[model samples]
Target: MSASKMKILISGAGIAGPCLAYWLARTHLNAAVTVMERSPTPRVTGQSIDIRGPAIEIMKRMNLEEAVRSRNTTEEGTIILNASGKPFAHFEGGDKGGDTFTAEYEILRADLVGLFLDATESLSNVKYLYGDSIKSLDQTEKTVKVTFAGGSSDTFDLVVAADGGISKTRDMILDEHITKNCYNFLGQYIAFFSIPSRPTDPKMWQWYNRPNGLCVMLRPHRNPATVGAYLCITTPARGQQDPAVEAALDEGVEAQKRILHEYLGNLGWETKRVLEGMDSAEDFYMSRAAQVKLPKWTNGRALVLGDAAHATFGVGTTLAIESAYILAGELSKIQSSEDIPRALERFEEVYRPLYTKSEGLPPFFPQFTFPQTSWVLWIRDSLLWFISKTKLYKLLPADEGSGLELPSYGWVDIHRKDE
Candidate 1:
């Protein structure tokens, strides 16, 4: 394998795959990157996600800021409503720059996926395979043979698993002793989708949480006539993966919908209307808050990145984009083909500070996010209200990144002026 002609196979084109492709095809790296997308075409289904923290810096490094901003929902912030539907606590706005619950620069997941595709699709070295997936991975000391679902097999010098939590490669190389099974079961599940928008809907993200660990949120989207609906609550261990994790991985989508209806129907604040429109929703997704742990991200010539190797509570996009940039940056500096393994090790070293076993929320988060009792809910709400009013969170150390001040590796910045 020659350094100039390194063959890199990246599975999953959602966010991480395409991002890795972009960096690999950059003038600095120029590695041949092939992206395998399981979806028949580009993914157009997903709720809104924020490009926050260092991920935003990566976006600017890629010069995708304005292009991403153009698709913003322009959400002012979030309004936490009481059972009576009155405002309880409010966060200014969840955007990339804002330190709200989400991000200040929130956009539809589909839009961000499209932006990545638009950036890398035209690159000469980047190729996208739609409706294809890896069936088997056979890695030797030299090359890794990948068998796709379409009955095609290819060998690549280096393989990257960006396919996400259910990744086949992640399972194959996973040291069971290090990372747990695909389902980490975070004691919470969330179902989110888009529904019809109303003329009188608030411009900001509106949320309602019941003391019994039930939550409903309605958020305005780019389409004036559409709203993003979200449901998340604590539940028993069984049937946790049905709704959001993998589209009821073990059951039917209808079953997932039925479960939602059975449990949430009694709740107020347009729950009935949202459930009524559920079937028509295009991007309904449900998932448990599970984290995939791997002692070492690399195994021989293959490695995992993003959610497949490091599934967290949230920040999927941020982690994926940032890791992609860093991975390519590290690989680009490789002195020769053999230096690749050292680069992969360096990549994990950079991410070790960011990786953690306990993913999501924070200390005593369950008592607040999914309060089991009323008194706890009231106390949690009061604390959040006080924090919101006093702006005291700013007094705490900023969570911009891990405590580690990372070394700056020069990154390629792509710029196109359409404005």
Candidate 2:
């Protein structure tokens, strides 16, 4: 039960899991952390994400700021385009660091994951298992016994599910009722992929909204040869699940692509080119926008963090980084493995409020943002043009900090030169 001898297993080698491992391995606890990812190799495909508020501080603490900045997507700004592919409104990028649609620290999700993995590579006690997952878990008061999909078994002092919002590992440990009640769907389905870039591609992020609740976004990437593309469709009502979307989610990639094509193929302004790129894209990801609202983050020796615990849209990456740091910090305060439950409780108590503050979307939100009629779209466009012309967006407050006073855990410095 000693701190040095403590063993922790983390599910999902995405942003949160590897980040948690990085901290746990470097903390005073010196816990041996094992990260299990279901994918055969590290996932190198995902939409772009940003780091804001306290997460930027945490990145500095982990000595990853320079490395992260080097991989920036280099998007100059955001441009809202009309159906004719002409810009009607423009918001400059966050180069000077005020609130803007494009953040200063914008990086692809895969690049961030790679950075975290590279950061933890030299840590002797941290291990990564690819093509493996937790088939089942048995938790007692002191430890958790895990059965892996690869037919291996191990006992760990603690188990953390940093998998994702739709975490299979979380389902294994939490009750069905608790799991069911935690989901708050925003009734929006999104598909992300990479499209071959052309000379005409704009350096700024181009957002095109069409009638019938359809939208297409194309953002510049660090690699000019390709661009990140997003296709979105909003349901009629909030919290309503579309049967077709559910079926597409249940089925494989082809079905998901079909659903997107059925909804957005006819819409012009790069729709045809985007769909063509999607057809050849090796990294097409689709998911519904849902928030996971868990009453408690820990159940016995098992705990969930990041999207597995609190998944929201706007500040997901920031929350993931902040939660991992807080969880590791809490564990560092404990003297023995027996104190883990208390530590886990403290982690939620301190972190949950910060998460809830960023949880909900504004009233109508994405629904209202995507107009369904021509008149409504005209109004939206006119309003955006007015706002842009007047520079009204500057009145919005900047994301200064997380408001939660971050605790000093006296973590050991694990700085390494980027390879």
Candidate 3:
């Protein structure tokens, strides 16, 4: 097998898949890259996420920084409020130790994904097959045969599962026990939806914490008439036995409305207001927070990267994009298909440690994020106040991309739409 004849199939065109496709083609790796997406089109719904660290460097290298920066949420700052909607502490969204509230680059997940799509739409070597997914994968010593949900089959030299934390392809390669162990659900549930904003709603992130382990947040979007609502609450073990949201999550917006109404209908501080149009909101998403801890990232011809292999807490996008960059760079160096396995190993060895370290949670992280008692709220708010007042937040680095050096991979002219 030669470099020009290599075929790579990637699942999930959300972020990592598209970014991987761009880099793979941009590096002139000579491999045909095809992204199979389960959805018909690019998802236009998701809360904002930061593109910090080395991931930002990749975007700049691709000449996508200005496009991404143009879509910044422009969030002013965060206001942590009490149960009664009274402000307890307000801080500018700047670097404050590891507790940095905002990064230099912040874009809504949908917008960022769109940026990737636009960036790669013109690349002749990259292909996208939407509205379909890999149903089963049967691999041999030389090639892997993939059967799609639409009853199509294809063979590829390598398959990358960027499908996400709950990867179905990972299950096809590994067992149920291994999958369970790899995913450590933080026993918490968060739901996001958009509600019509009030004229008085300020263009800032507003958070309200109650004495019942409930944290509600409102982030003003670029659309002034609508605001993004986020609700976080501690759930039971693993969130597998979710009698509350299991059917709701499967059913539709109406089911979500009924479940959320039963749990958060009576809360204060715009909680009820946000849930008013829940039945009509199409972007309602609720799921358990999880961290992926795979024993190994690759098995035979299949490789799992990004959220599928890492993604602890809520910050996994940047790491995912970075993983794509490294993996593509590694593959670009290979002259023959025989070296793919070793390249995959190098990708895991170089990134597994950094991603693993980032999965560590602070002491009583859930309690600090959403306190259930008055004392906890007081203590948490007081600590935030002290951190802000004393300027101790400056001790921490701004973004994790500090020392990461990006490889050029001889990718000088990779179809970048001019500056």
> Which candidate tops TM-score?
2
Error of 2 at 329 (Å): 0.3
TM-score of each: 0.89, 0.94, 0.92
lDDT (tens digit, per residue) of candidate 2 on 134-198: 89999888889999999999999999998899888878878777777787888888899998999
Write out the backbone clash pairs for model 3.
213-372
TM-score of 1: 0.89
Q: Please give the lDDT score at residue 253 for candidate 1.
A: 71
The residue-by-residue lDDT of candidate 3 on 1-419, one tens digit each, is 36357899999888889999888886656678898888898778888788877777778887888888788777767777876888766666644434367666777899899988988877777788889988999988778899999998999989999898888888886657667678777767778878888888876788887766677888878677678888877642343445667678788667766877887778888887787755678798877677788788886678887888787664688888888988888787777777788888888777777676566777666656677678977888888878777767667667756457765576535653232
lDDT of 1: 0.75
Candidate achieving higher lDDT, 1 or 3: 3
Worst 10 residues of 2 by lDDT: 410-419
Compose the digit string of candidate 1's lDDT tens values, residues 1-419: 25357788998988888888887766365567789888898879888887766677778767788988889987877777777888877676542224666565688988999999999877777888899888988988767899989999998878898988767778766567655654466667778888998888888888777766788888889889889998876744432433443444358677778778877888898788888878778788876666666678887677888888777666777778877878887787775567777888888887677554224547644436777677877887888789877766545443343333445765554423231
Order the numbered candidates by lDDT, best leading: 2, 3, 1
The models' CA-based lDDT, in order, is 0.75, 0.86, 0.78
